[model samples]
Target: MPPYFYKKRKRGAVSMNYSQAVNWIHSRLKFGIKPGLERMEWLMNQLGRPHTNILVVHIAGTNGKGSTLSFMRSILQEAGYSVGTFTSPYIETFNERISMNGIPVSDSEIAQLAAVMRPLVEKMEEELEESPTEFEVITAMAFYYFGSVNKPDVLLLETGLGGRLDSTNIAEPAVSVITNVGYDHMNILGDTISEIAAEKAGIIKKGIPVVTAAENREALTVIRQFAAKQQAPLYELGNHFSAAAKSRGEYGEIFDYAAPSLQLTSLMTNMKGRHQVKNAALAIAALEVLPLSLSEKEIREGIRQSSWSGRFEEIISTPKVIVDGAHNTEGINSLIDTVQRYYGDKIVHMIFSALKDKPYQEMISLLSEASDSITFTSFDFPRAETAENLFKAAKVQHKSFEEDWKKLLLQKMETMREDDVLIVTGSLYFISEVRNYCRKNFLEK
Candidate 1:
């Protein structure tokens, strides 16, 4: 049967709420690189160009974009400005992609908007020369929802893929942020570092200030050249701003950051990993250039209150279970560093999987250093690499290949003692599925 055939099952069904409507939309739409910005521009145009009404902080990079956006939203919200955030590839629900004032969009609201967008989306498919991709339609819906109700003062938009031609790059941002360049999506964004850097640097708009985390010399040079050409003020990490963690504990990390004009001391953040301190620093630097009214106190408080899930997240208490969406080599390296720092000399059981396109071999090589044993599993996505393929590549000692992931995870949990830690990671899709399973069976009362 065809993919669209599934949609026919619920064709005439009335969605009781927004959550259901979003589910229906996603059922029909697929994910991947549907290149070109014209379709997204057209979709937004149909929605009355909601991007113009709000101040957008567009962020792009191979990694750290989500963490940086989380920190920025916290700071802006603490400063007493209403903030909205839009991110991609949610861990759990589709609503996770859109937020109002730091909260996830409500189920009822999502359903209502889905109902309204359903007809428009269908019309576009029939009338327009080509149908907008899944991300494009959803991007339009998010902007419309944000504009229609409680128009926020600012919106932190994270790109779905490459920045230059990404669907989310249509907005004229107040400030652009690119968090370090690394080897990712090589097929689509070129195989060289300079090539990837150029794609990410596309987010740097003319005359807008851009804050970039410390990158390699070659990538840094490319970004600086782009900034100079665009006439945008470039704030590079370690030059204009820097951050270091003073102390780190199970609950959170304490860090100090210094931007060009603002200095903060011992800010508490619920996020783990030392890389997060750098992300927070980049966010502070970007906020420094914004014209919005804010104070140091607000920045400090926002840094403290910001929390993003599934980035080295410790879910369960006894026999501690951790989940991280470390799909790439860069992200896996960061996760490995955090594991070594926090759980020194402790053995770790790793549950891992990734997409077929990712550099799984490189990621597995790095992870093998920290992992004691591995339980390979696949996510419910077409591109997910199978357990057998991952197991063969890693060449690690493992256990039985249980058909059910939830059952397999629970069985592994039974073997783990209070001191042992199980790290569930690989792709965001696997992390999201594991998170949903844990919430339903283990975490929920």
Candidate 2:
């Protein structure tokens, strides 16, 4: 084994198998979501302070963080630069949280990184009164993996929770990017957009350039104040940079993007939604603000090829089976807008589920506006809301609940006519399950 795999803690350190390591990390959820930087600081100090060694693009937002990061990563990759990313709520595998380019870190690498973090995790639990949460542990692992081992040219870091107290905020990033700010985690982040924007603006470091795609005036005011206080240059969407959708279809979008230094018409993306155009434009603006060298061709091709999982992804074309991870009101609104644009004439049936902590009721109400029939379903997650509860909350007439999502989905698809669309959405976790099921069962056939 390489010395850097475990760094200086190779001696007397406990070695854990992959499953044991992952389970140990997930088990930290018992401590709940303790949001603070003190424990994270102490853990990083013990791990040789690796967070300071790498260049990062810090991204914090409510809905578009993952997709914006994907666009930026694909652009950088298209420009022939290697990129590392840190995102939360893994859709496919636990290792997906820490990845290079688009491929997740190998299981052996995860085992090695877990081995390095396990001892430190134990030390923290013994020394500190409050143990680290699951997010903090994963942040530590990502820091260990990227900051110490297999470092990439650029690391795109996404905040797990609010930006100020988020463990990922410990890193000093070259550029601070906020995809968009909206009402989410109201209990922890605050109830209003201004307060939430304040939390998102916490990532803007002193003298670092800040770029935002937030469209709300209240949110923009808060971000502007924060950036000005930090003396950070601010490049805002619909101001310094903008994107206008020219066309949208079931498979893709074509848009026009413009910035002070660059303007390109008819930019296209495989990813659906007008919001995606805004995300791509924000990504390009962030890259422009950075010191990296990139061409217009790379940016165009990146937008065209970049694909994000669990964000309006089409699973099977027949009956037009689409799945999206729209758990919040803002996300549902965006999904509905896309639906109206593409599937207004078609019969759209939306199957939904979400975490108990989210604003699932309002989300369901918003979803009912576009969906012809809404099916409420729950997954095997600790926080997932009951299908009956979601169904009961729906004010719309065409609504039902099913404990078994597979049966509901099969029935929906089997009964749908050629002009109908079946959408499975609610949470990213749920969409990932549906995505895997469809890939294994329908895509294969």
Question: Taking the tens digit of each residue's C-alpha lDDT, what string does model 2 give over 184-223?
Answer: 9999999899999999999999999999999899999999
Q: Show the colliding residue pairs in model 1.
A: 17-111, 18-110, 18-111
Per residue, candidate 1 scores C-alpha lDDT tens digits across 162-193 of 89999888889999999989999999999999
Q: Report clash pairs, candidate 2.
A: none
Candidate lDDT scores, in order, read 0.82, 0.89
* Candidate 2: C-alpha lDDT: 0.89
TM-score of each: 0.92, 0.97
The stretch of ten residues in a row with the least summed lDDT in candidate 1 is: 1-10
RMSD of each: 5.2, 1.4
Error of 1 at 435 (Å): 0.9
